[model samples]
Target chain A: MKITFAYWGNYTIAFISLFQKLGINVIPPEKTNQQSIIEGAKISPEMYCFPLKANIGNYLTAIKKGADTVFMVTSLSGSCRLRYYGIIQDKVLSEAGYKVNFVILNQNFIDIYQKLKKISGASFWQIVKAVYFFFKKLHLIEKLEKKAQYLRPREKIKGQTDQILRETFPQLEKVRNLRELTKLKREIKKKISEIEIDSKKNVPRIGIIGEIFTVTDGAINFGIEEKLGKQDIEVHREMDVTYHLKKIICPWKDWQIQKKINPYLKSTVGGHGRDAIFEMLNYTKNNFDGIIHLLPFGCMPEVVIRPILEKIHQETGIPFLSLSLDEQVAEAGINTRLEAFVDVVKNHYNNKNH
Target chain B: MKCYLGIDVGSVSTNLVLIDKENNVLFSLYIRTEGDPISAIKKGLKLLKEKIPENAEVVGVGTTGSARQLAGVITGADLIKNEITAHARGVAHFIPDVKTIIEIGGQDSKIIILENGVVVDFGLNLLCAAGTGSFLDAQSFRLKIPIQEFGKLALSSKQPTIISSRCTVFAESDMIHKQQIGHKTEDIVAGLCQGLARNFLANIAKGKNIKPPIVFEGGVSENLGMRKAFEEALKEKVIIPKYNTVMGAFGAALLVKEMSPQKSKFFGFGVIDKDIKCTSFQCKGCPNQCEVIEARIDGKVMARWGDRCGKWSNLNMNNI
Candidate 1:
């Protein structure tokens, strides 16, 4: 069966490796763009979150590209709209007259393995090996991304880190085994370190926190991380595919984070709102120069957390900027706001020194 | 006499201000952009030449506003700063104890919160024109009243009607409905001003701690009705500075005076008569087809910008 799934940063690489190892044909969705967003928004409910629309667009594009089976991950326990995305997408696709198989994975790891075996006729040991390779590749990409973040603000030549990171992705895709992966990792590290950087530049540190989809999706947010890096601001974003996977695997870690946010947010408000609050507090304690909270427009959980964030800002005297994104947001408007925010943060940082 | 020149090129208006060594305004001009910033800036410079004393020399130059980059390139400004910093600086110079600044310009509005003479936080309206000066300008035309006299009429209203300010389009329809229901012109006008005031408080100043000694400046600050509405809504008096219309330019001049750049980049008023042209083309290097802008003087490219990758920008770095 031809299988397709939405792309989420570098996690698509790990998924491709896993399915290939399992001997199942995989068709990855095209990179997100204006076309995908338009197609997705056309079919999605008016009030649905941006991620849902973008994912729908991805699925539709994959279907047109000859994929008959669509795979998606959903949460069974949360009250968030993410839990309903799979079923809603299924209904929408069926109504659109597409003959496709919909495979929805939940928290049950055993169930996922059984389904994979049924589809690919893979043995338990093969499945375990495939999973091992997937995790290894995912972790490696995560580490590389962290390194790129640090290098981006300091690189003497603008866009040098991004260019190197883009080039390394293909090399990563060609690796066949653990030895090759390790060698490739070492080579990439050496190349990235060779790039000239100003070690003495004192740049303001900014922590980005918010809904996972809006924060991590470059196309949706208009390349915020790159924009900030170009402005010589160090950006720290903790939300990523690997981090999300780790939270799912070790649910207790999320509970520990939730504990820190208990005083502000008593109960789970669904989605990533709770996590955003926890991360904001952590960044504040670390003495970050500023914080940017990004979320999709009409996001219920994020809207609920806006007031709480204001309280936090008032109490701590830490500057915070909230950006609500949708299809309608203009790129120039975002750029202007970011420029002004950087100026304020820089002035505040300089004033503190004297 | 030595002076520092500052230019604020906004969407609707372009302001030029020259300040002396003692921070006193030497000459200032406010001209309508009329969709051509280059000509507006040139006209202002021509006027400044006639107004300033023959002994005055421009020692430093600064540019601020939405089109600050373009203005800086044309004027060879020593410093280019955003409107938030420029406005904050201008307000602080007038009111040393000012803690909040409410600036509503042609297309955008902003709220700047300060503590101990340094900007602590600020917010800009996101692609919304509900509470901006342009919205009020449009309504004045529809109401068949001169824009200047619109605010004076509002002050005569005994009881203003309640109008929603959630969106400009919605507010316009609401105003039409009020007119159809036979609401008094003065009451409707007052309602519109109050509606804009509400929109500013709910959107731009949302969650912001606005304290006393707040200064209101920008093109919209000229509306007496808006000032009174803001005062009534917040239960606090809003101070309108003397140079409210040109505060951004005034602030930019003040900043350049403080900076005291060793070599002033002031191209001089003579550069305004030069033949400068700007054109843009889509770069096809990647999927993110950035529209790169190029500025030329006498057909020789002088500046290149708007490319996110800096590919084109780096090419003209020497010229800039």
Candidate 2:
């Protein structure tokens, strides 16, 4: 079978290596940025959810490049209205005059191997090689992201961490061996630390929680991390769609590194607020100055967690700013909150020092 | 000698279950909610106190369902669990090989997917009212038939019509049209069941891969007609457990029993009859104006919640 892999952002290198190992065509989406988010939301359903619009936008761009198939990971349980994402997007795309086949990879679904067989038309050894490479790329990306987080607040100039990350990402795509990948990981980490951060200034550490994809990807949050970076505040984010899906596939053992952060806080097994509640307590106990919980509009799980988190803030006296993103994720609105939050955290530290 | 108490407080029904250390069911009580959760809980507690053995010391108490928090504070619950975990645990305990759970309760419906005793994927509908038990109850009321008899009535039908199941209003209007066309009540009831089944399939069951050995429970599980409709739609037999109605309560009790018995954080049985008052105030901390609800017991704040950011209620340390 002739297959074309479609994805958003810079994940093209990872998919290229994975799909190439299987003798399949790996197609990259248009480079994602702030403009793509606005354009995507405008073209798609106004209320379909954030991840959906961005993903749909990305895939639509890739399909324009003659890509015939889109691969999306769907989790079995969680507040990610993302379970029905592939089917919904598939239908919506068809309605909008795009003819493309969508391959949904969900842990809950049985016969995944057979489904892959149907999509790839690859030999047994070839499929195994592709999967092995895919997982390897995943591990590399995770390592790179972890190092990226530690660098963001510490950088001398705002966007330095992002600049270093952007430069280092392409170098990772060239690596072929596990030893090479390990060295690259160490290099990223060391490079991140070398960027001068104020050692004497004890800035308040704030966490951003809620909605796996939107929190991690800068396109959805509109570079809020960079805004916080300018204020010398270390921002910790704990949601990743890749980690959520990997955890489902490997329940017996840890599949992602962040699991070590809080092993007890699992995904909402019932599609509820348990993850938020557990994370809230963990963030509070860790003595973080505040938390910024982000969620999509009409998210049921976050709706339930709102009261619990409000209670957490009440108990811990932690300043929390909750932002619910939908289609109208304007740059001005985002920057206003980011600037105010940083100011509040700055004032908090200043008062504590006195 | 160990005793376990399980309570499920839902929007429409309150259920209580008593199980011994061996997990043997000793007593079960299910009652209507009537909008006042506190009153329903009081009635349930009174019935439980009267029915259970006086000397049987309740070693552990567990609460589940939508009102699990409120029930936990009032009943001194040792464990508070969500409906999904409770249902999955209860089903796994009773039938180890259970793979799927289709629970349709009052005001809500859920689909639980389990692989090797752990929940892999689950879906619930709290937004829509089309496929839930309350939808069936309202339809039954509109048809002037008791809910229990509606299932049997549906089974007697020969031909069932395909009515609009997207919205409740559309379904009711379609049902009225079918009635005017001289259709049999049994057939119309059967058609309604099919409509609900179709709605569940289109909405909650979309993109879900349903496996066999499915267990159907909750208030709507009593509807044999709906069970047949689902079986026919999926081309697989639906399995209904012995104590399907109280599965959430049973699941909660089982979870509590799994833990080492501890002093329950329960407020005691006196809380059942006590005049509990609830008041709300708009928080002026910011522009959000989050309405914080405070529950007072004997003029003391026992529990406070309902804020969007926890600025107001998180300050109350007396209850914690």
DockQ of each: 0.51, 0.01
Clashing pairs in 1: none
lDDT of 2 by residue, A88-155 (tens): 87887788888887788775635566777666688788778777766777766765666556666766
Model 2 lDDT at residue B305:
66
Q: For residue B184, give model 1's deviation from the true position in Å.
A: 1.9
Q: TM-score of the candidate numbered 2?
A: 0.53
Instruction: For each candidate in the order shown, give its overall lDDT on alpha carbons.
Output: 0.87, 0.73
TM-score of chain B of each: 0.97, 0.94
Per-residue CA lDDT of model 1 for A18-128, tens digit only, reads 888898998877766666777888878878877888888888888888999988888777778878878988987787787889998775687788888998999989999
* TM (B chain), model 2: 0.94
